[model samples]
Target: MSLENTRHPAGPGLDELVPSRYALRVGDIDVLVVSDGILSLPTKMLAHDADPAVRAAWLKDMFLPPEMVDWALNVVVVRSGDRTILVDAGWGADPNLPRAGRLAQRLEAAGIDLGSVTDVVLTHMHMDHIGGLLVDGIKDRLRPDLRIHVAAAEVEFWASPDFSRTSMPPGFPDALRTAAKRFLNEYRSQLRLFEEKCEVAPGVVATRTGGHTPGHSVVRLASGGDRLTFAGDAVFTVGFEHPDWHNGFEHFPEESARVRVRLLRELAETGELLVATHMPFPSVGHVAVAGDVFRWIPAIWDY
Candidate 1:
């Protein structure tokens, strides 16, 4: 596979509508990369406290604006045999994040019915990752067949009494805790929690790689001889080049950096396809050791 250096246009006021879906066949399993839309985060909000000059240089090299970073909200959908699994729910019609909440639309474009999703494997309880699980404040439990899988430690951490006291911007932690509780209560019967590593589906396994959040995880899918890892925010493109540059949203920045480096090295050596949730639209790629750090070579459009 040849690497293509395709630079996506970036700036304010640009039309946000781009191809929001991509398809790949991993042996017998079908995988789809769906977009919820783009999120415009101030460059400073990410990799916070890093030297401004260093951050600006990296942005310049990547052709991104130094003031703001536009990140694609990529969600993974997996269909293995009889199961239709969604990796992470997108922002889902959230009023605060007007640009996002388009996952339902993109799923329809990909010919996936919302009712057909058998399982939702969440990497963590971040709003963007779990917001789409509900529609109009209602969990789609009428189907009775839909199940939600998350890490046990994640649920414990968020549900703990002290979770709301975490050092976060004013009401953010409280809001997060509320959202998590709502999701858990709404899907209580359908909720399943795993620890360390365990199979979530026939060809899918969830491995705990906490750092970004207390119980953040990455899901691996294998069928026949092909493998793919849904690396849910383990790092972004910039993180590959500088694993030490921590995201401001990380619960444990130091541990997040350590996990990022370890995972990147392992992914590079194994040569498995990695799908990052916040890289670029269709954030599927391969990792490679580049000098002292790592590099991301995006997978060619497999459509």
Candidate 2:
């Protein structure tokens, strides 16, 4: 169904319209999951080198379609005391790609004003993640005042002209260049580039977990004893079931796998809330360690 066709009333199975957003409070810090809608990609995008049987088994286990991979666009909203921070913007409208551009309404539904967003913590520079940074309804320029935070390496990789000429896949160089220029022109002052670890705010800190992108990072939110990791796209679909399986969308698959393994293991051991961008709806859960493998247990809310 198209973004406009599906209507998800408060119910189960995550109906198409207005997918669920969940929130949890920890010592005055509110972590909210804002739905940006979902999109489908070719199944091969999940694993480039896996055996067909292995891929088939993964599809069967997840009850996903064998031909298409469904991906959810989830943007995290963190309300820490006085700051209303948005981590990783969602998908803007694209004629070629259908099921996107639903974030603005969802943010409204969550009672979050775009103008009120003080900071944007990016995990990477992928289009699906950063496309929403640009103003949609308006014709020109992105939000000028919003502090858009990203890793230095990520900004360098995506913004570099050499990257567009040397690294971008065939037929994508022009598009990449356009995007790079747009980011540079529209969000220059708002862009706060950081290296390694940097404290974004009082409750959130950028953790170095590069691989998905050159300088991809995850945001860690902690208050009192409760903590949560906004794991952007470190691991996409079936992240726990196959943390070793490198995502095809990642810039460096090998490095991404290493980072995934380390991050998953740590989250499993520490028992922190894992908020992933692409999981099931309201992608809030905990990773359980079983022997050397990890298991994803979805949140069982009282609502």
Candidate 3:
């Protein structure tokens, strides 16, 4: 049902130490999870509103560093009915972020060509989720008529994105603004704006869930009774134990919390597979309700 290779470093001459892709099946659809690499961010961004001591304790308990966290950027590729859908693009370019932005080379290594992607379903326009599309020569390599699906509200919000409630690091707000504006100008013609939900393929659906951003959304894939939801930024690693904790990048922290709790509950009840953007690499897992909070149960790799 799933295939992943994480043995040791690559044989030889490969820049990456290990394979960065995970493959699985949701009924008839083939899904591949690729790592765009990791982002090193401040630990406080994980929960800006939480008590500092408590937050630090939580990180300590998890054996994570108190000052910084390496958040994983997981992107997915889906194949269904002649359609190749890219769920989200990873980081593109940042002089300070050399560790991230490996989506393009990794995709090629996985044998997927840029021109074969029929559609790009953006969870939202946040740089990490859309920046790979901005990389040099990326546009020329992609099919000229490739369709990009995004929530209408998301596109509208970025026209003049308001970061009033967010709590990002010093240079993030301005950087985000620039990337979003550039993406809009370059891809306006390719955008296929949807009001609420859109079907990217036969069994893949993208539904707008306004919280993190006005049009942030999650992709749900269902086929022959198998289900998996790619919850893009709707939930983080700490969210299960403390769904109320507000992540700094959230434009509407309170609303983001509400969305996280709702989505977590729904996943728990359904007992379906869950993959999130910022969870550890190979983020495939299941959700379970534990007393008052939820729990993440990582699925064993099929290998």
- The best candidate by TM-score is 3
Expressed as tens digits, the lDDT of each residue in 1-303 for candidate 1 is: 001111232234332456777778787788888888887777865677679998888889889898877878989888887788889998777677788888876665555667778888999988779888866843643357777888888888777734321244456667677778887787778878888887867889889999888889999999898999998988787887788886867888888889899998988989999998898878888999976699899888753
lDDT of 3 at 81: 85
Highest-scoring model, lDDT: 3
Give me candidate 3's TM-score against the actual structure: 0.96
C-alpha TM-scores of all predictions: 0.89, 0.87, 0.96
By the lDDT metric, which is better: model 1 or model 3?
Answer: 3
What's the lDDT of the predicted structure labeled candidate 2?
A: 0.73
lDDT of 1: 0.79
| Per-residue lDDT of candidate 3, residues 211-242 (tens digit) | 99999999999999999999999999999999
Q: Which sections of candidate 2 miss by over 4 Å?
A: 1-18, 137-144, 161-177
The regions of model 3 sitting more than 4 angstroms off are 1-15
lDDT values, one for every candidate: 0.79, 0.73, 0.92
Clashes per candidate (backbone, < 3 Å): 0, 3, 0
**Winner on lDDT (1 vs 2):** 1
